[model samples]
Every structure is written in C-alpha cells, then in structure tokens.
Target chain A: MKKLHYSELWCSSPRYWGGLAALTFIILLGMAAAYYMEHSGHWVTGMSNQVVWGLPHVFAIFLIVAASGALNVASIGSVFGGPLYKPLGRFSGLLAIGLLAGGLVVLLLDLGRPERLIVAITHYNFKSIFAWNIILYTGFFTIVGIYLWAMIDRKAQKFYQVTGFAAFFWRLALTTGTGSIFGFLVAREAYDAAIMAPMFIIMSFSYGLAFFIITLMSAYWWASRELGSHRLEKLKNLLGVFVGAVLYFSLVYHLTNLYITQHHGIERFILLDGGVYTVMFWLGQITIGGIIPLFMLYSPAFSDNRFAIAIASVMVLIGGFVQIYVIVIGGQAFPMNLFPGKEVVSSSFFDGVVAAYTPSLAEGVLGLAGIAIAMTLVAVGARMLKVLPESLEDPEQGTA
Target chain B: MSGNREQPKEIKRREFIGMTVLAAGAASVAPGILLTVAHATAEAEGASSEVRWGLLIDSNKCAESCNACVDACNRENGIDLLQRPQGQGDEMWDAQRPQWIRKVKLKDNQTGEVTNLPMMCQHCEFPPCVDVCPTAASFKRADGIVLVDRHTCIGCRYCMMACPYKARSFIHQNVEQQTLRSPRGKGCVESCNLCVHRIDAGATTTACQDACDKDGHQAILFGDLRDPESALSKALREKSSRQIRADLELNTGVRYTSL
Candidate 1:
C-alpha cells in the first residue's frame, strides 16, 4: 500500500456504505425512542425506581470508557512517544470523539430531569458524584478534540506538546470520575468498596484496548487485505494481554471481596445465589467476556483470524454490560440498608427481605434505543465530518 | 471614587427604593429558599443549636389497633389517599410514600416476635440524603432535623439512595395521590418533616405526637433533645433507645424501645 491521503478513503466502499446505513438506521430508531420516552414520561421505558439505571447508564459508561480507550491509540503513540505505535495515532483520536459523543447521548436520555441537566452545571453540589461526572466528561471530550486537531495542524506545533501529556491524564480523570459515581456511594454496600473505582479504571483499559484493537485491525483492511493481516496479529497479541489483565483484575476484585466475610453474603447473592444475575455475570462476563475471549486470544490459529477478533470485541463489550449489571443492579437487589436487624430474610427470592428488581421491556427497549442513537450519530459523524481517515496506509518514519 | 460618593446622594433615593424591592424579593425567596435546612433553625429564635430534637416511642405502650398518629399526619399534610406512593410493593421505591407516618412490624429480640410500631423520617444528624442531593433540596438543620423543599425538588430521588432509614418517599404518577390536597405532581419527593409547618405556628409537638397523646397510650414523645427536662430527652437519658438500622451510623431522631 502506497502512502495515501484522506480523500482516497473517503470514496465509498462496500464496508463504509453498509456501516453508514446500519448506523443511520440505529440513530433514527434512537431518536424515535427518545421521543417516545419524553411523551411517556419514563413509564414508556421499563425502568422503575428499584432499577433506577439500567442499560443506558451502563452503556453510557461503556462508551465513555471506550472513548477514552480510543484516544489511547493516539495519546499512547504520540504523548508517550510510542515511536513504533505512531502509525495508528490520529485514527484513535477521531474514534475517541465519536464514542464520547455517543456516550453523552445515552446519558442525557437516562437523566430524570433532562431539561435541567445544564442546570446541573450552574447548581453544583460539592458532594454529588453525578454533578462531577458531567464536568469531567465534557472537559475530557473538549481536550481530546483539541489535542487531536493540534496533531493535524502544522501551524500550531507547541499546543500538541502541552496537550500530549495533558490529554492522557484528562482521560484518566474522566474514567476515575465515572467510577467514583458508583464507587463512592457508601450507602450502596455493593459499590462501597474503594477497589471498585480502580477496578472500573482497569475495565476501561480492557474495553478500550479490545475495542480499539478490533476497530484498528478492521479499519486497516481499507488499505488492502495484506496490511490488515500483520496489524491484526499485533492487535491479537495485545488483546491476549488485555484479556488476561481483565480476568486477573476481575478475579482479584471478587476474591478480595470474598476474603472478608462481611461481603460474603452479598457476594454470594451475586455470584452464587443470585439466579438470573449470577448466570449473566458468569456467562456474559466470565465465560464469554473472559474465558472464551481469553481462550480464543491465546489460540494462535483463532486469535489471528479477523473474524475472531471482531467476535471477541463483541463478546467483551457484552461482557462489560454484565459486569456493570452485577454491580449496579445486583447491588440494588440486596436490601438498600443492610445494617441487619431481626429482618426477615424473606424465604422466597422475590418476596425476600432483600430488594429484588427485574427490568421491564420498556426498560430494556430504552437501553436498546440509547445504543441505536449512539451508533447512528457516530455513523453520520463519520460521513459528514470526514472523521474516518482517507488512508489506512502507514507512511515510513519521518515521511510527510 | 470620591466624586461618585458625593453624587450618590441624588441617586441614593432611587437606589434605596431599588434596595427595598430587592429586600422584599429576598424575604419572599428566603423562607422558600432556605427551606431545606432553615425550617428547624428558623423556628429556633427562642431555641438554641444545642437543643437537638429527638423522638422516643415505647412499643409496649403502643397499641396496634390505634393509628391516630397516621390520621393526624395525613390530615395535617393534606395528603389524600390517592397521592400516596406504593409502599414496599409498587415498582419504583424511590421514597415516594407521603403518609409521613407508618405502622411497621419490627422484631422484638426479647420476645423473638414482630412488634407493631408507627414510623416516620428519622431526621439524621449526618443526613446522607442532603449530601447526594444534586439540588440543595434535601438538607439538615443545625438543630438536627432533615427537611426537603417541596417546590425545588426535582424528584430525582438520589436522597432516597442516601437515606439509611428509607424514610423519604417520591410522588410517583402525580400529586393526586393525596386526595384531599392540591396535586403535587409525580416527580416531587415528600417525607416526614417532623411537622416544621406546625412548629412555625408555635406548636409544642407534631400532629402525630399530639394524636398519640389523644390515643391515651402516650407511646410517643417528641421534644427538644438538649433540654433534659423535655420528656423525650429525659426518656433518652433514662431508657436506652435504638434507632432502626443502627449499624448505618446515622444519628437518627427516631428511637423505639423493645417491649
């Protein structure tokens, strides 16, 4: 593949056309859902007070983390001076912006007082994690955008140098803020652990790397089939490493929780006794998210396959949904105030003393609707803004 | 700067009128604005900060048949039966129930049995609801009563997540949950105020406490916690009282003794 510019790839290809169409369809559906939710006043969605946040909250966080991860492609290679890793830099930055915007869309839809969201900026509650999250997310998005554009602008060379280092820390802080929203909720015994904040950070790394690796490996195909193959191997190896880390962190997180008897009951309620939630945690996260991806990544024959990496990315993403669910929904399922008394541990699971929640269809659809909106917007963005680069071919070192 | 001050006398008359209007605006907003925390403190001109308010209810003295406290609270708050949130049953448990008073069956360790007692907001010293509230709607007074602003409440119910007692309730669907009063709407959070409205009128106790007295059992006591002479404070000094879910570390105003 010869050295290429943005115009060459902007020309429509089968992959681009299909991707754009699918994305547009999803976004249109999301807009429809949002309209439905607004008129329905939240009752249209399955969300109840018991399960206050469902798919939208989890997916929004996922997109944010993924967005940060996408930025890592550029920030890592550029700011950290990854000389060999420089080839994929701008692509990462562009993807980062797209994903962040998607995350924001989902988040706004979930907010109880949507119109007053801006009002959140004016009325700051020092202790409120939700308020802090709004600032962190917006700030991170702006910095990532400026840093990326600075990379392209030959006129302003010095700005990139400052943003180069600043962007990495800014992204990290964004993920940290996201985690603290749940981690600092001392009242929710499930999320009370300090480890959760850091665990969530690690999750961002896993999801980010897995997503960026798959996207990069796939995008490289635009240059030619041969170019993507070599890059695919590099990404496959990186993903293997990331999967191992995700598994190790997940094990440590739960094991440490179990090491103490105090958390054992709730932990068991999640991992063991927590029926549907437990199955989803184990199957969606542990098996598909961890074991299957881990096994496939390790198997050279399978890991090298382009199809396999895509499958793994999808699996890992789905697994992330379960990971968040086990914490947020699983946490709420347990009685909110567990400071025990002669509390009747309700003999029946649903009827038990512990609070139980099941997502209604409205709840589930609203979540799906959020995803559709994000995909559609990103697709349209790629089309309108020329966010997708013209070339996937990497020029030799020092080539203008 | 010196010349401006001399010229201000001519303009001062206009400015004074403007200032008066601003003060009037402040006065109107102040009672409504300082609502989250100030109700208890606002009434405390005669009282002091050291004077904490607490409640003591003896379950043995409480008769299960009588719920005069519930009736009194409902009547006082103008909470009609319709506006009430689903209690422990309906889907959304974001603290929407507004009877403010409740009859719960808590276990008795000595008898190994469930005992019936009326319950309401504990009004904790370190109110979690206030801290997580995005708006300053949920707040605690210096005198230790936790209160909510009905007008400012966006009804996000983040406070519901924070409260250990699960004392707060959301007005799900609409305010018509209360049949007798003005419809408050679906999205506002309402809870036991410790009857701040009556307190402003110089009432010695809440409607619930007064109703309890009328019931003849004298099972409940409400008073200033600082004055040792108050029945509640004296009872606290005498009998060991336990707040519901004591492990939560909330310095709750609600206390009940085992039979």
Candidate 2:
C-alpha cells in the first residue's frame, strides 16, 4: 500500500473565503434568532404548552445523533482495521466534534433558562436519562478528542487502538442515551419502546454517514483533490446498508406498535389519520429518505454517478429529519390518554385534540444555523490542521 | 405635719408608678409569649411524611357548568393574572398560559354517561415528573405535594412530557405579576402544587375545595390520607374511588369516585 500524506485546506482561495463568509453570516443570524427567542420568551415562537419542543429540538437532536455516527469512519479504520478508511480518520474525528459542538450550542440556547446551565451541570438526578445524557455528551467530546490526538500525534500512535475502542464504545453510549431520551418517556405512546434506542442508533448511522459523504465530496471538490471513485463507491454502499437497516427498524417499530392494542391509537394516528405526520412518514421518510436513496445507491444506473450518489445522501438526511420530526412533534401532538375508556367531551385545556405546531421563522433560522456552525467548525479545522488526506486516488497496478 | 404628708404622698405616687410599669411590662410580654406559642404550633404542623396530603373528588357531585374550582385555583395560584404578551394571538396565548387546574368532561364510550371532574397534578407517590427531572427540581414534598423548584429548573420540559395526566404547564412568557404565595416566573415548569401554601399555613382545605363547597357541590375534599378519622378518609371508605390510569400503578394521591 502507498504511504499516506496529509495537508491543510488551502485558505487563500476566493471560494474558501466566500464559503467562510457565508457560514459566518448564518451563524450570526442564528445567534440573533436565539437572542430574540431568549429575550421575548417562547411565546414569540410557535411552541406552546402542548408542543413544548419544536423545530429547534429536531435540529439539535439530529446533529447530536449524527455527531456519534460521524466518528464511525474513524472507528472502522482504527478499531476494525479497515486500511482504506484509516487515512480518513483525522477528518472524521474533526467532523464528529464539529457536529456535536453545533448540536450542543443549539440545545443550550433553546433552553428556557439557558443562563442557568451551571445548575444542570452541578445538579444531577441519577434516575433521569437526561442527566445521564449530559455526561455521555461531554464524555463523547473528551473521548473523541483523545482518539483524534492518537490519530494525529506520532508519539501517541501506539495508543490509537485503545483510544479508538474507548471512543467507539462511548459513541454507542451517547447514541443510546439520546434514544433513551425518547424511549424512557412512558407518558407518550409513540416513545417508551426499547426499540427506540436501536432505531436511533441505526438512524445515526445513516445520517452521520450521509453527512460525512456530502462534506467529503464538497471539500474535495472545492480543494481540487483527487477523490477516487472506489472510495466514493465504498462509502455510498455502506450508506445504503445503513439506510436499509433504518427502514427495517422502522418496520419493526410500527409493526410492534400495531400488535399491541393499547398502542393502536398512536399507530393509527401516525400511519393512517395523522395528517402531516402520516404524510411525512410515507412520503418524506419512507419514499424520499429510504427507498429512493437505497435505489440510487444499489442500482447500476445511478450507483456509479457521483451526482446521483450525492442526491441520495441528501435525501437520506432529509428523511432522517422527517423521521425525528414525526417522533418528537407528532408524538407530542397525540393527546395523552387521560381516560382510557372515556372520550373527552370538553376541557379548557386542548384535551382529546391534536396539538398544533407551525415552525416560526426564528425557529427555522436557528435550526439552519446549527448546520452552518457544524460546517464552519469543520471548515476552520481543515484550514488550520492537517486533517484531510492529500489525495484518495486509487493506486496504479502493482504499485503496492 | 407638712413633711409627713409630703412623704406619704411620694410613697403613694411611687407605688402607683411601679404598678403601672409592671402592668405595661406584663401586657407587652403576654403577646410575645402567645405569639411564640402560635409559632411553635405552626412549626409543629410543618409538612411531615407521616401525614400524606391528598385530594378525593366525587365526580357525581361535580357540576358540569360550575367552574368555581378551576377559577378559584387560578385566583389562588395567580394563574389568572398572566396576561397575553402583545402581538400574541388569542388562540396561541390560550395554549401558552399556565393552567394549574382545569375542568374536564368525559363521556363513557360504552354507556354514554358523562362525568364532570377537575383534572390537575395527581401528586403521585412515584411521580414520573420527579423521576424524569434531570436536576431533581421536580420533587415530592415530605407530605406528598409535588413541586418544581424554580431556581434549579432548567426548563427542559422533560417533566411535562413525562407526566401522564397533562398535569404540568411550561411558563412560556415572562410573568410580571404573580401571587406572593406562588412566585412563578418565565421558563420554568409548573403544575398544581395542591395549594401547598395553604397546607403549610395550617389551613385544612385548598382553594379548589373551598370554592367547590361555596358552589354547594362539595365535589373536592382535601385532607391527610394518613388520618383515618379525617373526612377524606371516611368518604373514601364509604365510596369506591379509583385513580386515573391506575393501570400504570403510579399510586396517585388524587382519587376520584363515581367515575
């Protein structure tokens, strides 16, 4: 095998400057949006007592889940001994940290009392899965940071495998903690299933890989790097498998819910009657996010086409967002079964009726800003550090 | 003879002055002694684990049109004073405002028999809100009243999501005006605290129960569940009461009869 060489992203290019400027603009806008929401209170937003978590949560959760998945590439290289993936570890580590930072920023800013974050850190209720998640998330950064150091530092190279193993397990725990945030909620019918944890893990795999692919492609394309078709093919194929796994989990989740008589109402709401949620499930998640991407990745006609592969990855991301939206927002929309055998005829509270939510401009801006922040971090890291491999070109015959 | 008269007058005057001073001292000390005794009595009545506070409601006695309990709770908790922020839509404001208690009318699916009752935080022995709170801000008092510590509440809303009865409400807007008893603010999760201030003050009843009695329905009865001779315990023994969502086995402090 050829010896690997790494280089920093060229910062002198006009395109680089332009991209940085755009990301900075978006980040500024997001900050403003956050400030507006914080100052005016949540009443200014579409979120109400019924739909307490809105668009910001969807974005925050997506980024957090995806952050763990982004590290999968590094884990595969260092832990599993995938030779081709080894060289990509540095960038993968950078991307993972970037995604997590972006996600955490959004989550913190969206809190009702964001100023009192110190209380959250100091006070912990051991029984709460949320409290556990705070530890998991912070631990992820520490572990991944060490893993990245192991990859980059020549002196620390010997510890790569050990750090990789730790980071791998830590990422799994992080994703599990994220999933349990929903799974442990016994009050909601849509959540509270053991399957939620595994499903979220699968979702992270798909979303993280999709994000990694798009970022890799965009960065290489911009920097005039020789990214070989073989590497692209391998990554896209893996993405397809993750997508298929997600679809399988989705099927099992719904099927299991359907079998239980108690869950029939929630199942029916998501599958058949829930207007926006049902449409998002079938049209956005299953078709656009799942089936089409699988087709693009597996089919002979589209698999080789880089543009098609990119589109497929984008679709997977869109589907992932829709899936989370359905889970978070749609789950809350279904009114709780206060009276199992009784129909709520009237109440001052919006009982027995679906809660309504419309994403406000500020919410949308804030969500997009998280993505911009993640991209900015990756961009800046690449520019400053020798994270990216010099080239991913296929070796000539007999070169090894 | 003049000196002797003067000396007698001085002694009489001195005696009168001393008697008046003693009277004033006793009068001042008496109220202080009485107040200390009252304070001690109040302290003795402080929330105790032995006395489990709970509410027992008779659905049959709840009048459908009378919203006295909910209205009274709003007044008592200062929930009625929350004003809609300027530019907030009426519908949105209605959904965002904090509601400690609300009247709910349920129709039995099989029998078509309608039942009217008030719904609020049940103050479960094992409250899911308390269990899910990351900061332990949502906690059950020693006497079984579940409350959110506003200072520590990060306003994650996880507690609201965990609650089964839709009992909790998030304060979405800045609360400029709040009752001294409630002390609510924006960005914190709140629910029915079962009129804990009244309970702490040694009041035997809640605002909801008081209003229900004034309305002559007398649907709500507040008392110590531990007290066997209390009116709530006696009524519970006479009537078969069931907790909402008893299947969850939460062992709720609030129980409803004729539902």
Candidate 3:
C-alpha cells in the first residue's frame, strides 16, 4: 500500500456529542451502583457464598477476553504482514487499550475493598494465577501502548515488528491467564478442564473479530467514508474459522467429560437437567453465538451482505455473554459434592442445592457501564488522534 | 564537610578487641530476644511445629439431628449475629449469612446407613485455599490452623471457589460488633480456624468440641495429631477414621470416625 493518510474523526458533530453524553450517563450510573454495592455490602446483590462472582464479572471477563482478541487484527497486519489488515491496525490497537481499561474498571470496582487494590499490586503471590494475571494485564498496557506508538511514529516504525510480536504473545498469555482462572479451579467440576485455556483463546479470537468488524463498519458509515467489500470479506472469513474452532473445543470438552464416570453428574447438570444453563448452552451459546455466525459468514447468500455480517457479529457478542455466564455463574450454581456417595440432606448453608442467582439492577447497570466506557474511550480517542484511516477505497494503492 | 568529621575514625587494636567482645555479647542475647525454639508437648510461647493440631469427630456418637456444634461455632465466630437488612426473610437471611460450620446429615445409599457430622474448614496440610490465595491472606498456621487474615484478605473469594469442602464463607454484608476474637466484615472470605484464639489462650479445645462435650455427645475431640499419645491420634489408630473426599489427598487436620 502507498502511505496511508490518517485524520482525526470530527468531534463537533451532534452525533458524536450525543453518543458521548449517553455513554457518560451510563458510566456515572454504573459508578453509583458500584458505590451502593460496596457501601451496603454484596448482600444487596444476588451474589452469595455460592455464586461469588456475578453479572459484573461476566461483562468484565468478556471485555477482558475480547480486548486480547481485538489486537489480533493488528497482529495479523504487523506480525504476520497481512497487507489487507495493515490499515485497520491502528484502530485495532486503540480498541484493545480501550476495552482493557473498561474491563479493569468494572473488575476493580467490584472488589471487596476497591480501595485496597494497592495490596493486589504490591503483594506477590507467585503460586496464584490471579497474581500472574495482574502482571500480564499491566504488562499488556505497556507493551500495547508501545506497539501503538511504534505504528504511529515514523522514527519508531522500524521497531513495530518487535513490539507487535511482544504484544501478540502478551495478549495470548493474557487470555490464557483469563481462562486458567477458571481452569485452575480444581474444586469446581465444571471448571477443572485443561481445555478452558485454548477454548478461551478461540473464544477471544471470534468475539474480538466480531467486535472489530462491527466497529469498523459503523465508524466508517458514521464518517460517510467508504470501506471496501474486500476488507470485510477478509474479516468475515477469519471470524467463521474462529467460531468453528470454538465449537470444536466445546464439543471435545463435553465429550471428554462424558467419558469420565466421575464427571457424569456435572455433564448431566450442564447438558440436560441444568434448566437455565442448558437452555443458555444450546440456544444462547451454540445456536445463536456459534451456528448463526458461522452461517452468516460462510453462506453464499449472506456472504456479500454487510447487514447480515453485522447481525452475525452482534449475535456472536450476545452468545459470548451467555457463554461466560454459563462458565462462571453456572459453574458455581452446581453444589460441591463434599460427600461423594452420601447425600447431604440438610445444612446451615445451602449445600447440595443448585444455588440461585438473579442479577440485580445495580449489577446490570455496572455491566453495561463497562461497555459504555469502552465505546466512549474509542469515540473520544478517534476524534482527537489520527487513528482511523482516511479511506480503504483505492484497491490499486492498497497493499493487497 | 559532613563526611570529613565522621570518616576520620580509626580503631586501635585494644579498642577493636573491646568492640568485638561487646558484639559477641549482643549476639549471645539476640536469640533469646528474636528467636523462640520448639519444645515437645509443651507451650513454648508460640504455635509449635512439634504439634499438628487436629480434630477427630466420632460420627457414631454424634446425633443425626443435632446442631449444637453449628450453633456454638456461629456464636463463637459472631456469624449468627451478623447484621443484615431489617425485615429480610428468614430464607434470604439464611442464604446470606456467613456460616463457619454446619450440621450435615448424610445418608449412604448403598448401606442405608445415616451419618451425622459437623463440617467446617479441614485445615489441610496442603490447602488448595492457601495455594490459590492471591495475597496469601488465606493461610495455614504453623500448628495447622487455616485462617483468613482479615487485614490482608482482598475478598476476591478465589479461595472460596477453590475449597473442595465448601467450608469457606464470604461475608456478604457489612458487620459491626463482631466477637472479640473474630473481626467480621463484608467481602472477605472466612472459615473455621479451630478456635485459634482459645487455643492460643491455653484453652485445650475448640468451641464446637466443648459444646459437643457439654451436650454429652463427646463426638468432637481436639488434640495434637503429631503426638502419637494424643487422644486424636490414639482414636485414629484405634478406630477407622477417614477424611471426607480423601481422594483429593488433602491430608486434612479434621478426621471423621464411623462414617
């Protein structure tokens, strides 16, 4: 490609200010919810000893995972030298940073003592994966920040490959760390699988690409700029492959569990009798998140249609939330079988019963706030910086 | 100018010999001030390595419907009186309450035999809670008591998720006027510490064990597992006691008899 010209997205438009206002309002509301939950204690929320992590975690985790995946476009461009993806690289890096910042905000706010986050930073517990993740998350920001800078600065352009590669590997570690947060949980039958790590990586890839494609299409549309069908095709095809990979992992994970006699009860709970979770698995995660997206991306009828692709991206996002919900809350709902053969008839705590959790309105606001915060960052940053490309219209001038 | 006055001192041989003697004298007394060594079967002013504090519960002696231990534990830990929103339903408050110990009535399908046990933190030698704690707040004492250090606990509750026994409870509400020994608070995960405060204060057993004995059940026995002559150890040797979920190989400090 010839030298691509970048410009700041105009900030004066009513559409821009309106979007910013809406996002800020939601963010403030979320902050208030967090304060209430913190001050009044977690009892106000539906979260109990059983379902320790609630709705906010679902959104925070999804965003964090999606953040790592968002950088894949830049990785393909800079790390693998994908000519078609090079123009999208700057926007991809910015999105990754924005998404991470948003996710971290929700997570920190949800902490038992949000003020004592300094302890999490200063204390070293190498044995815990959570401690390792803190390093990975902070390191990701520094590495990706440098990677973004390298892409933008003419003097630092030569070092793009090094920084880009570092960011790529860092993101992989970040997602893997995120997955292992559940996977390392040996006590929970639902989370003790090794596949969670790779599954999350693939999940990140699909969710990230879906997010990127949607944002790319809409941002260009809002600017009244042309985004070629060729660029869309590249992203669409890659998204299908990722979605398929996730399905394969999900299949193997269940199959592996089915093979083990010890795991039969958990499998039965998740696949068959686990009412809400079962429906979520089949309808939300598999059918909506997985199958529909695959059909949209690969089907000849919908392949060329931008609207279909957009719908599929949104479906994948919806599915991503349900999938995380199943993994986190569903896993907790299944009671721990402290006594293998003997059935626990009664207990002071709700033992041997599927724990109940209904996400409170406060939690809902907090979760949506995370998404709004991410969008706001993207909106403000795009307006102030030379992030978005001028156009992807001229094929003759394009690297592809 | 500041360095010139301090840097010029050179010690003579006699003065150096005198200084060395004084240093040796300080070193000799330092161990007494800073160090406390282990003594067998005796309280040597700190938790001892020679004693592995453990609990032995006789399921046969425990009544199937009894909750004395649970109630005692609740009273001792200030868990029973934890503040909640007024007018909250009993079921809602029960679910929200922090339970350090609970009466579990288990029925064996194969033999049609029923077992009654009070379940709490097993205080494992290699506790998964301790392993997964991000801040090392969920820690095991030198004497094998697993307790949450409230000061350091971040309330992430990853330890609660990691616990196989479901022994840990997260305080989901703001607390006030907690028991003198256990300072209760919201967001932090807590579990039975075998009444470490009582043990440290020279009490021979935990609150639950004392409650059970007072109730005339004599099901719960607390003693040193490391000492072969200890009642807990003797009971283990004489009776077939098993750890719940022994397949995990946690080597728990809490053992059950006649299960």
Candidate 4:
C-alpha cells in the first residue's frame, strides 16, 4: 500500500476563525443558560419532579454513545487490521475524545448542583450503575488517549494494536454501562430489560459511525480535499449494516416487551398513543433514521452516490436524537403503577396522569451548546494536528 | 510551643452573672431556634439497626376529608412555607413543589370500592432509592429512616426515579425562612424521613400521629418494630395489613389496613 501523508487544516483562513468564533459564542451562551437555571433554580425550566431528566440528558447521552462508536474506525484499523480504515484512525480517535468531553460537560452542567461534582467523584457507591459509569467514562478517555498516541507517534507505533484492543473492549463496556443506567431501573417498565444494554451497543455502532462519516465528509469538503469514493463506499456499507443491526435490536426489544403481559402498557404507549414519542419512534427512528438510510445505502441507483450516503448519515443522527427523546422522556411520561388494579382517583402530585414536558429556550440552547462544543473541538483539533490523511487510494490502483 | 507564660484571669463575678442573664434572654426569645444545630443531633449514640422504626395506618378509619397528617407533616418539615415562583400557575407550582407526604384517593377496578390514605416514605429494608444513589446522599439510617443528606446531595434526582411509591421530591426552588426542624434548601432530593428529628430527640412519636390523635381519627400508629410491646407492633399483629407493592419484597416499615 502507498504511504499515507497526514497534515493539519491551514489555520489562516477567515472561515476557520469565523467558525471557531461561532462555536465559542454558542458555548458562552450555554454557560450563561446554565447559570440562569442554577441561579433561578430548576423551577424556571419545564422539568419537574415527575420528569427529572429533560433535553440535556438526551443530548448528553446521545453524544456519549456516539463517542464510543466514533472509535470504531481506529479499532478496525489497528485491532481488525483493515488497511483502508487505517489511514482514518488518527482523526477517529480525536473525534471520539472531543465528543465525550462535550457530552460530559453538558451532563455536568445539567446537574441540580453542578458545583458538587467533586462529591460525586469522591463518594463512590459501588452498587449504583452510575458510579461504575463514572469510572468507565474516565477510563475510556485515558485508554483512548494512549491509543491515539500509539497510532500517531512513530516510536510508540508498536503499542497500537495492544492499546486499540484494550480500547475496543473498554468502549464496549462503557456503552453497556450507559445502557444499563436505564436497564437497571426496575421502577420504570420501559427500561427494565436485559435487551437495553445490547440495544445500546447496536445503537452506538450505528450512531457513532454516522457521526464519523459526517465529520469526515464535512471536514474534507471544507478543506477542499478529495475523500475517495472507494473509502466512502466501505464506510457507507459498514454504516448500513450497523443501522440494520440497530433496527433488528429495536424490533427485538419491542417484540420481547410485547410478548410479556407486564410490558404491554409501555409497548402500547411507545408504539401507539405516546403522541410525540410515537411520531419520533416511527418517523424519526424507524423511517428516516433506519429504513430510508438502508434504502439509500443498498439501492443500486444511489449505491455510489456520496451525497445520498451523507444524507443517510444525517438522517441516522436525527433518528438517534429522536430515539433518545422517546426513551428518556417518553418513559418518564408514563405514570408509575403504585396501585395495580385501582385507579388513582386523586393525587396531590399529578399521579396516574401523563406528565407533560416542554423544552424551554434555556434547555434548547444548552443542548445546542453540547453539539457546538463537540464540533469546535473537532474543528480546532483538525486545524492544529496532523490527524486527517491525504487520500485512501490502494497501492495497486494508486491513480484511482 | 509552650506558651503558658501568662495565664489570663477569669471573668469577674459580676461579668459572669451578666453573661449568664444575656444567654438566658437569648434562649427565651429564640425558643427552639439554635441556628447552628441540626434537628437530628449528631449525638455520640448513632441510630441503632436493632430498633426498626415504622408507621401503621388503618386506612378504613382515616377520614376522607381530613388531611391532618399531611398538614402536620408539612408544618413540621416547613414544606407549607415553600413559595411558588412569580409567573408559574398554582397547578404548575403544586405539581412541582416538594411533597414529603400527601393524601391519595384510590378506587378499585372491579368492586368499585373507594379508599383514602395518607402516603409517605415506606422506609423499606431494601430501598431502591438508597441503592441507586450515586453519591450515597440518599441513605437509610441504621434505624431504617431513609433520608437525603442535603449537604452531599448533587441533586441528580436518580432517587426520585428509582422510587416506586413517588415518595421522594426534588426541591425545585430556594426557600428563605426554612424551619429549624427541617432546614430544606433548593437542589436536593428529600422525602419523609419518618420525622427523624422527633425520633432522635426520643419524642417517642411523630407530628402526624399527634395531629391524627388530635383530630380524633386514631388511624396512625408509630413505634419500634424491635419492641413487641410497642403499639405499632401490637396493631400489626392484631390487624391484617399489607405493604404497598409487596411483590417487590421491599419489607416496608409502613403498612396499611383496609386498602
């Protein structure tokens, strides 16, 4: 194979500074919104006792799950030994770290007492899935950091596979931990299942790959560089397979829930009368996120169309967000069955009623800030380091 | 390091008497307001696991219109004084406010039988809230009173999510003049600590029990599970009572009859 050349995006352009400036502004806005919510109290937001987590969690979790998936490129190159994917490894590692940092920032800021973050770190309850996740998340950063060094630095190149393999397993555990955050909740009918963990793994694969493809295309296009169709087709096919896997897992989750009499209520709510959640599941996750992407990727007419593949990737990302909203918010909206057969004739705390949540402007801005922060890190990292490769042409067909 | 060169003289007899009078006057004016002290004193003897505290309620005798226990709990915990934000509606504020206890009305599906009961923290032997709390802020005392340590609580509200009975409440807004008994603040999860202050002070009963007795309901009973002679234990032995969501096998301290 021909040797791959890597270089930084030129930093002198007006567009580069302009984009960075825009990202900085959004980060500041998000910080300000966080301060307003903290100072005025959570009462200003639409979130209540009923729905403890809101849009911020949805954004944070989606980015975190995608972060785990983003490292797949490096895993394929170093662990699985895919020659075409090896050149994209460095940037993939960078994107994974940047996305995780962004997600963590959003999650920490959304806390009721963000200042007590130190307490959460210090006070470890081993039984809690959340405490274990804290270790997994931090460990992921360290392992991925070493993995990146192994891939980039020539002297440390020998350790690439060792570190990559370790990272591969760590990221899987991290995603499983994330999925179990919901799965372990026996109180909520929607999440108490073993399928949630594996479903999350499948989702990470699809969402992470989608995010990686989009970032690669956008960065290359902006720099006026050629991202070869040969490489794009390989990524396109992998993304299609992951998306199909996600659909299969989702189908299994619903089918399994449907089979059980206890879970019938939650299944009905999501598949039928959950209103926005139902729309998000069918249109956002299934149609736009899954079915359409599969069609565009596999169809003979659009098989080679790079634009169609990119569009599919974007759809998957949108679908990923919709899926999270449905899981996090929709699950909470359904009332807990405190009394099995009896109806709650009256309750002081809006019991036995569907809880309503409207995302406020502050929450919306905070969610955007998470996206902007991730993109900014990616933008700055690309400009500063020799991450992106010159081309992905095979040695036999160098002219192509 | 050995600075015993000049020992200071003690205060004069007149100064001592004047200081004593001043302290007495201050104590009289404040009545139970020792601002620095927590209600549940950090006494040398911590709560004992041997003595399991619980509440027994006979819901059949619980008057439908009477919310004495709810009112008493609110007053004792300062939940009543919590103010709604300026623009929010009454219904919105009511739905969002911290509720330590509440009156719930339930109707059966088949028999169309109706019942009313005051519900609070079940104080389970194996609390899901305590189990899920990442910071260990939501903890069960040795005496089986599940309470939130506001000092350490990061207010993630995972406890609220884990609770099956909807017992825990998140403090949504800051309160100015909180009662000394329950100095609640914003950004923390809290629930009925089973009147831990009273329990710790050796009061032998709770405000809700007192209020119920005063209202002539005699529906609520409070005592220790370890002591078989306790009124609560005797009532449980005599009456056919059930724990809410007994299928979970949480072994709740609170039991209700005629539900």
TM-score of each: 0.83, 0.94, 0.92, 0.94
Where is model 2 more than 4 Å wrong at Cα? A396-400, B1-46
Q: Between 2 and 4, whose DockQ is larger?
A: 4
Q: Write the per-residue lDDT of candidate 2 for residues B167-258, one digit (tens) a residue.
A: 88998888889998998978999999989888887799999999999989999999999999999999999999999989878999999999
Tell me which of candidates 1 and 2 scores higher on TM-score: 2
lDDT of 1 by residue, A46-164 (tens): 44544455666767778887777667767767777764455566566767776788778777765555666556667767777766777787788788778866776657657877887
Model 1 residue runs over 4 Å out of place are: A1-4, A7-25, A43-45, A214-227, A337-341, A345-352, A384-400, B1-50, B63-75, B78-102, B108-111, B150-155, B176-183
What's model 3's overall lDDT?
A: 0.88
DockQ of each: 0.18, 0.66, 0.53, 0.71
TM-score pick, better of 1 and 4: 4
Q: Native-contact fraction for each model?
A: 0.23, 0.83, 0.77, 0.79
Second chain TM-score for model 1: 0.72
Clashes of 1: 17
For residue B24, give model 1's deviation from the true position in Å: 25
Task: Pick out the ten consecutive residues of candidate 2 chain B with the lowest summed lDDT.
Answer: B38-47
Candidate 3: Cα lDDT at A183: 93
Off by over 4 Å in 4: A394-400, B1-42
How good is the docking of model 4, by CAPRI class? Answer: medium
lDDT agreement with native, every candidate? 0.67, 0.92, 0.88, 0.89
Question: Tens digits of per-residue lDDT for model 1 on B1-259?
Answer: 8888878786898899999999999999888877845655665574347878778888878876787888888787776454323333443432223546766555634556766677678888777788887767787777777877654565566776666555665554443334322334455666787777666556778888889889788888888977878878788888887877666677788888863
Q: TM-score, B chain, candidate 2?
A: 0.84
lDDT of 4 by residue, A121-234 (tens): 999899999899999999999999999888878999888889999999999999999999999888789988999999998899999999999999988877878788888999
